[model samples]
Target: MDNISARENRQARLKRMLAPTSAVFIGGASMIPAVDNCRARGFQGPIYVVNPRRSELAGIPCVPNIASLPEVPEVAFIAVPRENVVGVVGELSAIGVAGAICNSAGFSEMRGGEQAQRDLVAAAGEMPVIGPNCPGVANFADRSVFMMDFFGEHDQNGSVALISNGGSYLSDLGSSDRSLPVAYSVGLGNQAMITAADVLDVVLDDERIRAVNIYFESIRNSAALSAAALKAARKGIPVIAIKGGRTTAGQRATQSHTASLAGDDTVASALFKRLGFVQVSTHTEALETLKMLVHAPKVKGRRTAYATSSGTYAVLGSDIAEANGLDLQPPSAEAAAEIEKHLPPFVHAANPLDIVSSADDGKKTLDIYRAFLSGNLDVAVNVMCYPPEGGWDPTTWDTNTTMFAQAARERGLPAAFVNTMPEMISRSVRERMIAEGLVPLQGLEDGLRAVSNAIRSSELAEIVARKSDEEILLPLYSANVTNPIALDEASAKAELANVGISVPRSVVVKPDQATSFEDLTFPVVVKALSADLSHKSELGAVALSLGTSDEAWRAVCSMAENLKKTAPEIAVSDFLVEEMVKDGVGELLVGIRRVDGIGLALTIGIGGTQAELLRDTATILLPASRDTIAEALRSLKLYQMLDGWRGRRKGDVEAAVDTIQKFSQFAISNGERFVEAEINPVIVRPQGKGVVAVDAVMRLAR
Candidate 1:
């Protein structure tokens, strides 16, 4: 087909698949819920059940085969056993069906099922297939439901679109008693034809979707989804994600669950952060984050205030806020005076604006909220908790919630509520708060963390949206090798220096030609250069702090002898003598390593002998902006030391950032040539002085 016609055909096919007028279900009693779901969705289109053993199912006429169908259905739900799924799909495709939702198991996820899954894909050429082993698909806008089981009563026009790889979460999110407004949801089992990225692309095109919730075991087509997500983020639609397989056991489970190949999680996290996705760790976090994005205004700053009746809540809230990077600033004296008007004389008016717990009425809570909203703060949080024995009064709570939500909206401020106890708040009350545009958070710690995450995501989205042409990624090295080859220290340092990075002045000479010392400083370091030996220090091939010419010469002779006697297999073609660097404030490790799916990951961390014990590192996606580099450095635990901890002089962080940028460019340009490149003990000096790389290594791909 030509370009225009092909595009048109795809568009039409997608329309039919998303809003199919008629659908076929190919199974027996297992498809009862699907039929009920179809009825509940108000799908007035024809429903054909193709079961050889049954004459009719759930009042729908059952046909013997695809050939016996009265008309070509727009879509088919294949629920047959795995062994027969490919043949059934082929038959349906021949009948000109637009797409199929293969809700069968035992495909590629199981042993000996790979070929069968391949056959199923081959059979459905040019037709969109949801999954060969999945929970199925649901479209609220068009009422196109195709699942073997029902979660709960769903709205016909929900706003949140969820796409996941796991079925249980899909069902859980769909059936949520909390009434999460999910419009479109699908579990892309196996993702043979339609991947998560493809589904994300389609869902993003829907104007009704205000947010996207995705839970993935792994990302197969990261680049495509990244672009799609970035587009959504720019349009102010948040993409919230929960990535499984972060731990070793979880990784193994994920591979078995969906035939997914989980890669380095740090790289994946960097990718998500770079693309402006709000990554969460749990279903609750994802839902809460989405709620904030959908309803709350953009957070202007971190300054926050809380209104609560209990003094203990004030303390708890303060701790949680500080832990999550939220600043619970004390109210200004003027603001405190304003709050004093509502509270009793014994109640101290502070940031958490402690209201007397013994107070009988909600006046103090409401007045404190008013004061918080009017004060010089970016956001407000209200803690509303009541014991069951305190006599549950719905009227007072309802009035208080409504007033709080209304005041926030009228004042153009973002506010959320923390129900200390999940069971304390009634379902109807929570729903009402949500409807009134107030984010009602349950569970104290979870609520606080959620609020902080929401604020940070908003800030990050704004930053990403404002970014322009601030990054340029160089081309990958054009090498066709298969194995990695280690480069000698001299060669590695030379490569780094060529990329505009500073290195210690060094001279390489054969064992017999080393009649030097006039051209070099007295106190120098000597090392035997050999690609075969990665750790020269361990092999006694290193000589440090030689104070004299004779001392350096004798060290080189001793290293050669040690190598020849102790480790004869190691080849030493030359030796390097380099001037020692002592004026250093700190040592750092800077390097690049390939991350599967994503490209090379540029990493920086605390270095020297403590590197292994501290294990403080930060990985950033390559070709990052200077601001990103600086932000990453600030995120490290060692930032305090680098920023002049304990009244010490600060390290030259700007110099380090510049060196990192240059290294990133070189790594990007030579991605295919090397598997890894690193400089250990990159001596960081005082501010204004540049950093110097003292030791280096490079591993080239064969």
Candidate 2:
């Protein structure tokens, strides 16, 4: 498949196969909600409900089967028994339905039915399906509702959109029953048929849908979703995602709730962070992120002014803002001075504009708020929790809050109203806040988190979309034959060294070989050279700091003997002897992964096995520039060590990052053909000295 042919094929698929589909065929007796939902949503398209026996439903005509459909249904939803689903999908495909939603049970999530699940997968080639056990879908922009709950009167804000696998969970937030701007949503149960990426592919064209809510149980085509997410971010449209599971219990709930195969959630978190999503946990919070997506004004650059009523809120917000890698700073002097006229003596006119909640005068409230929103301030924060009013007219608190809010809206700046009671904030208040284009957050923490995430996603998207240079994508090559696989340390380094990465000097000796010929001196580390020994050190397959040659020989002999005892199948190539890296300030773990929902993600964290347990890691999009790299590293909890902790000399942070950055680019370049690559303990020596990779592991995509 050449590029031209592929492009032509895709173009044909778009024109001949996919169009703004109207009237989807609903298949299943259990899909009563989907059928009822379609009618309530005022679906302009025709309905062809498919069931074994049903004459009429929701006042729409029903068909006995797919063959009776009046015309080639644009979309077909198969919600029959698992055994019958594949066959029904075949009929829908034969009749020319472009897309299908499979709500059948007994797929991958089914217990002890691996063969049945595999058979179900085989039937997916006929048409795209959402789930084998999904509740259904909803498209607010097109007025198509396939889920039971989203039919309630929703806000037509037109800026933000949501997609979720747990439709009812999110709909509970919609139960605020307040009008909102919703584009579409879907509860993709198993995603065995129609995928999240496929839905994005269909809806990305909706200009009315400025943002997207990507709800998922598992990420299948992460590359496609990443591209779409990046696209949305570049366009200043936000994607708020509520991945179904992150805990063992959550993963189990995902399996039982909607019948999905949930994997490691850390991967999902990193992916969402990279691919431009405001990741939330519950369905309610998922919608909360829409505040930032729809209300906040897009910045021309990364510059931002952070304002808060409380100094503490401002400080925490600033910390969070910077941590997620934002430029939250005090408002400019001119901006502060403008607000000073209204500030009380107790409330200093600071960047945070801490207008001490003690003030009761309406004029003071309006004056300070107006100054912050006077276009001079880029964004402002208001800590609203009904501050102690001394029992003044309870309505007085309401009046003051409303007046202050109105002033901010009157101006062009984006302001966030943070309530201390996160879950307690009324839905009506939230809807009112959104109507005025105000970002309302549950607490000070939530507010800062949402804004910071949006800013990072927006900035990274801009950077990636505009990128078109060599630096944007680095080159990598292995010195040894890559097909057979490069196992030796020297071979791995030769390949990495080409791209400017550093590797420890080493001498390789064959298994059972003597230390006499080993060129590397004493106090060296010995590692068994076998692909199977990926985590060599973990299984005592590696020895470090062998001060004596006898110890080095014994370690090598021990590793070889161990491998033979464990599994004679693993062919031992050679034993690696290299100086044990000890001069580095601290160990750093660098890795590149193609995330399930997002594309190329580069992760940097504290080294050793506890890395995953601590989750003390930072994630960023691949091909990041040096400036962004520095910013991301600076946000780490280990940044103090990197910055010369406890009088120890600072490591060559720039050089170490350069190597990690290069590795990330390499992984991205090989993304089409590789699954993931990791290099642990990229030891960074003192300043002026470079870093070296002690070991690495690369997993090829099967």
Candidate 3:
């Protein structure tokens, strides 16, 4: 099928699954909760229960079988035994059902369920299936709830969608007391036929969704996910995600620095950033971030204004704000003058303004807030903690919060009601804040971090907006290597030099060849030339800084002797003699490698022997522009030294960037022909001189 047609078909199936007109439950009593949940969510359509043994389920008469149903269901929830899931799905598919949620477990996740999973997929055919081991979906917007598990009462009017690979996590997030505005919740389960990308593509089409939060253990389809994320960016919807299982357990074992540094998690991080998704570390941050995005307008900048009645909160807020990259500048001179009029004589006007207890009056608090927000800030935050009911009268707290919200609204600024502790804010106050058009952020640290993430989302949106579809989409290639070839240093350098990257003048000669050194420069370096010698220095196969022809020849002989003792099984027949790079400013490691699920990734970082020890690297997914390459370079800490540190001469940064860009283009053009390529310690000379690839390695798969 064509791309558009396939997408349309997938989307159509998803629409039916998420908002089915008529549904059938294919099981006995275990499917009762799904039926009841669907009905409780106000599903007015007919719901059929299919079980040959039971005549009734959850007050509904059972139809006995799929053949006995009154009408063809738009969707089905199959909770039969694992062995019968395939047959049921095939029957539904034959009947032209839109989709099915295979609630049956023991597929793909179990030790001996691989073939069953494959059989399930084959049975599904073109019909979309959510999971064989997943909790079904819950769509609050259309009031279609087909979930197997009970996730507390939720309002139909919500703006965020939660999707997860783990069923329990989805249930927990849906039932959490954080009061997140949830529009849809889906547990992906095994993702038999339907993937997270497929779900996201359909979810993004919902106009009611303002933000999406996902918890994924792995990304099954990167290209589709990238396209969906680009659509989200264009539509100005933020995607917050928490990726599980971040270990490098099954990464390819290669001798290249790229493989060591650019692990699966690192590449995934780069992919998320490139796709303009906000990746959070914990569920709290994800929930808090979703609240920020759903409740307020996007923060335009980092300039923030913090206001609190307690001095301690003011100090804590200031510290948290700074730590999270929020720019909490002091109030302007005119605004300070205006704020001082409301504060007592002892209080000073500043950012994180402490309006002491003396200014307890509602009118004075509102005046102070108005004055504080007048300082040209992008966001306004108020730190307020309400005591438990009956412990203290909340009349003053309510009045102050109302005034604070009013002041921020009058100024046309996004505002947040931040509490020091998560439990300090009651449900009533949180709902009130939401009604007042303000975000009620629970924890101080998580709230500030969420604010930072929200602001970063805005920035990333702008960046993604400037990129074309071609640039935004990653070129994911299949990894089918039958014949693999690892190129020696000379051949690798030739490949790099062919692409306009600078390489030193070099000559490859046999160890037994009688060669004249007059053609080469006086000061030269010698190294054993063999594809098997990945770490030449560690293998005692490298010799450097020879000042003359005899010295170079002697170094080559010594290298042969050392290699014989180090690796006697290998025969080093040839050696590489090259001129030493002089007056170099620094070294850099530029590498490109294809990750299994992800596409080709370009990693640039501090090079030389300590590259892994420093670990100061930044990655960019390929099909990236030169501007993106430069940005990645600039993010590295070594960029400071390359750009001239402590009055030192600047390295040829432009040359380095150009080299990396060309290298990336070469990888893209070659596609699956090559698996990995790296240039360690690409000596970057002083500004205007150029960069030279001194040491290199490359592996090709045919």
Candidate with best lDDT: 3
Q: Across residues 1-702, which tens digit of lDDT does each residue of candidate 2 receive? A: 785665344334332222335655555445677677676766766677766577875566787777877788666666666668668766766666666666566767768756665666676454555666766666655566666444355534455555556556546654543334665655667766556765665566667766677777767765556556655655556667777665552332210111111224665765565565667765545554566656667633444555444577667666766675556555556767877767656666655556657346777677766666664445555665643335334454454556566786686656666775565555666666666666667755656666665665566556556654322332232221223233344555566777778787677887655547356656888887765565565566788778977788788888788878776776886887887777787777776654434445567776665555555677765666777677777777977787788997898888877887788767656646654556776887888888888877665543
Report the candidate with higher TM-score, 1 versus 3. 3
Report the alpha-carbon TM-score of model 2 versus the true structure: 0.73
Q: Which residues of candidate 1, in runs, are more than 4 Å off?
A: 1-16, 52-54, 89-96, 111-119, 247-263, 356-368, 386-391, 469-482, 497-500, 505-522, 528-541, 548-550, 560-577, 634-655, 685-690
TM-scores for every predicted model: 0.86, 0.73, 0.95
What is the Å distance of residue 561 in model 3 from its true position? Answer: 2.5
> For candidate 1, what is the TM-score?
0.86
The residue-by-residue lDDT of candidate 3 on 220-287, one tens digit each, is 77888888888898898999988998866225545688878888888888999999999999988898
Q: Order the candidates by TM-score, highest first — what do you get?
A: 3, 1, 2
Off by over 4 Å in 2: 1-29, 51-54, 58-62, 112-126, 148-151, 155-157, 247-266, 299-365, 371-376, 385-398, 409-411, 419-458, 469-515, 518-680, 683-702
Global lDDT of each model?
A: 0.76, 0.62, 0.86
Clashing pairs in 1: 481-702, 482-702, 483-702
Q: What overall lDDT, based on C-alpha atoms, would model 1 receive against the true structure?
A: 0.76
lDDT of 1 by residue, 298-411 (tens): 776788877776778888878888898888877878878877787777876787766554244566656666776777777777776844645766566566667678767766
